[model samples]
Target: MKNLGRVTPATALVLESLLSADSVWGLQIVKDTGKKPGTVYPILERLEAAGWVQGEWETSEERKGPRRRYYRLLADARPLARDFVRAQRSKASSAVRPTPAFNEGGWSAV
Candidate 1:
């Protein structure tokens, strides 16, 4: 798999969603991540381009809507994706600062 460059929070969410299942369609991913279609599709494309994901158009004709592109996290790239997710989570947690308690009189830094 090639280098994925920058892994944004949106990309991390997409990776987490993909990790939850064997394969997922684009719309499902959008819904799962609660991210806009514009945000999710490009990430999927990037993942596919980076060789971390493989996307195949659904062949079954039983469904009534447009053909869905299902994306799967390539087995070889799973470890890398997981490590990225973990690192993003670690950064997010560490970057969070506790909010100061609210005061009825006025706002205080402490």
Candidate 2:
């Protein structure tokens, strides 16, 4: 279950942005996810290693500051995310009852 494997909510936001745009910078992803620089960079490294994303230095156009690393998704990851969404919808449609597990309030009977 690659969908469930490593893509936490925060990582999913980064991936979604890459999917929508041609390429995005680290700072943009940081803005989109609202996570600190400390958290976002490590996740980018993991995604790049996993082949879900490819990153490169911004070239040609110069900015006020140093050029940033732009990220884009691999062709494969898009389908995986789509299929994952479909599977979740299918599961939801066929679900029998509400989840029984509980934590803070009280535990459900086994």
Candidate 3:
């Protein structure tokens, strides 16, 4: 819609998805958006490099879960959400199936 610069629509979906949730792993994002991880991970890396998102290893002992990298939108990108909402409220574009990239039938959620 607007000048997304180097960031593509896939990147936006990733950011928006994280903004909607607390934090999510690289693969879960793929599942949620039905996009290939090959495409999704790079976007995540770019987002992290741009400081728009942050990823960290998560450790949990309750279920003995392995370390997982979780991503969340940075503080700076938080304001953009409101602006996006305001813009979406007015303009109508339903064909925009702006989901993240992932291999739909290739992987199972772990």
Give the candidate number with the greatest lDDT: 1
Candidate 3 lDDT score relative to the true structure: 0.70
Which runs in model 2 stand beyond 4 Å of their true positions? 1-4, 83-110
lDDT of 1 by residue, 1-110 (tens): 89988899899999999999999999999999999999999999999999999999999999998999999999998998898899889999989987776799786657
Clashing pairs for model 3 are 35-101, 35-102, 36-101, 36-102, 36-103
Model 3 C-alpha lDDT per residue in residues 1-110, reported as the tens digit of each score: 12335445566566667777878887899887677999889888876776777899877757565767899877777777546544554344664546554476764433
Candidate closest to the true structure, highest TM-score: 1
Please, what is the whole-model Cα lDDT of each candidate in the order they appear? 0.93, 0.74, 0.70
Q: Which scores greater on TM-score, model 2 or model 3?
A: 2
lDDT of 2 by residue, 1-110 (tens): 13347456566666666667878899998888788988888888888887777899988575677889998877878877555445555666777566677778887733
The per-candidate count of clashes, in order, stands at: 0, 0, 5
Q: Which 10-residue window in model 1 sums to the lowest lDDT?
A: 101-110
Candidate 2 residue pairs that clash: none
Can you rank all candidates by lDDT, best first? 1, 2, 3
* TM-score of each model, paired residue for residue: 0.88, 0.67, 0.64
Evaluation by lDDT, superior candidate among 1 and 3: 1
